[model samples]
Target: MEVVFERVEGRRYRVGVRRSGRHDTGPDVPPRVGVGAPVGDVPHDLVHLAIEEALGLRLGIFGQVAAGGDLGGFFTPPPADRSPLRDKRRSQRLARAGRSDTGLSESLAACVGHDGRLRGADELLTPAELGRVQRRLTALVDAWRATPPGGELVVTWPEHLTVRRGVLPSD
Candidate 1:
């Protein structure tokens, strides 16, 4: 798996991921997946694809940011250069309420449904979703603690992207 990061603005990073493919390529062309979201734009499709590929199943999971902070600050190549005449109020709402945290998990749950099952568009997160992300992070830390480090996993925190990673110093 290959992870690509493009600087957006502030602490935000636009992440592009390409991983091992199971599909076969034509004799003349290589099979490639183009997953992109316009800078500063929410790449929901790309995110869904990442989760599906990572977890081996599609999900109704959604990523949200708080309505109080700069949304572009979460990804790389942010779209701050756009017109400011847009709806500042609604934008603020999304910024403040849409941030990643339990809020993200909540939104994922909402997308799938309030029930914690992974049904059609109503399935947001399974206990497995939480476990998958946690395990992935732990493995990264463990690998770093080991020798001959190889894989790269970027964990971004523009203004602290929190989602329960074991216990903090105080806990």
Candidate 2:
């Protein structure tokens, strides 16, 4: 599976954890779940963080579905027909994207130079420190389940999903 991104509206964005396969590129591309906010120029670090976190959760969900007694003896494999080597490569990409230390933060701060108020995750990471950003993201996901019913915030799973075949780029 690959991480695909789409814009809902304005800064609101949705990133899909799509299994490879299928060519319908319209609004109905791969079955994707929304994560974080929609964005136009998302910083490199946030994109990586969102993809890694979302993929990890989706994999867990797949495992659960396969293990459910309803599946019976049927077994489901991991996404993308990925071998262990391919999986490692994908992981490395995510790690690289998510890498943000104090230095990047300092540089980003100088660039922005108090130009505007921070929005979304930016409010919490003006310096773009990875550890701080990761902690904030954990808090957000924890609250995902606690969002009140019918609230603007919601976390849901599709009725069903199938992972298809596709080539994931090393970059």
Candidate 3:
């Protein structure tokens, strides 16, 4: 799935996801806008993405989105598929996605916002992996700050972060 981060102006921003198998976001695109006063130089969700990708949190927010979960209406569903039963099954599938390092991702994201660093070697990430997160955050924040208002900074949430097709995870 494609993650779109748009600079509305100043600290205002909009974030939206284009799910897999989707192309050409026309006028009907759901406006997943967030007007947040983010603590760090980068948006909070962006931090989550960077940290999550570095640590590989498959059942995290973006991963759920990639697997087509609306994430409690953070994203809007397609107009064509209106079946509530289908939605229920999707939710069930997501629940079956089980635990991920989402809690860790959140903690690390908060750490970056406050202390701006991660200590060497822990259960969540090793020294090298922490270094990777720092490097990635640096690059992503640099690019994000450079983007002009009304412009988009596109990102990809790895689809394989979720379960493989047809291999139903036990509930």
Candidate 4:
């Protein structure tokens, strides 16, 4: 899946995701998933991506999406057919939310969501991991900054980190 962040205006951005093959949708989820909102220092989801990817939190928000699971309402699903069975299947797939890293990524992203850098998150990440996430965020934010209005920064969800049944975090 490719995550595209488009700059709509100063401090405003929209995120559109395109997954290979048919998009996963259900009774409550749309065929397409995306969001548009005001941005602070950097895009909120971008922070989630940076922290989760750097820390290998595969069952976090992006991982859920990559595996075609609706992440509650954090990401907006635009259009699609609704099926009760599909929704139930999606729920089963997302059951991995019980993993600590899932919530850990959400909490960690909040720490740097708007500020675009890590702050006081040492407990969640070791010193080495924190440094890595910070560095990765800096690079991602830079790319987003350099993108002109109407332009987009597209990133691929790492294939190895994508959530899969029978494969999950040790925790």
Lowest summed lDDT window (length 10), candidate 2 = 65-74
What's the best-to-worst order under lDDT? 4, 3, 2, 1
Q: Candidate 1: misplaced stretches above 4 Å?
A: 1-81, 85-90, 96-130, 143-171
lDDT tens readout by residue for model 3, 1-171 = 678889888877888866544422211236566634454556777887888777677766666566655543454544564565665576557645634555666677667653334443366677788888988887778888889999999887665565444455542
Largest lDDT belongs to which candidate? Answer: 4
The TM-score of candidate 4 is: 0.76
The residue pairs found clashing in candidate 3 are none
lDDT of 1 by residue, 23-102 (tens): 21011111122233321222232333234333432111212221112233332222455434332443344444434443
Candidate 1 vs candidate 3: the TM-score winner is: 3
> Candidate 4: global Cα-lDDT?
0.68
Tens digit of per-residue lDDT, candidate 4, span 82-152: 55565446655575563576688767876774657788797887899999999989989999889999888
Winner by lDDT between candidate 3 and candidate 2:
3
Cα TM-score per model: 0.26, 0.23, 0.78, 0.76
Model 1 — TM-score against the truth? 0.26
Q: Tell me the lDDT of candidate 1.
A: 0.31
Off by over 4 Å in 4: 21-39, 72-84, 95-99, 113-115, 165-171
**Superposed model 2: Cα runs more than 4 Å off:** 1-77, 101-169
- Please give the ranking of all candidate structures by TM-score, highest first, separated by commas: 3, 4, 1, 2
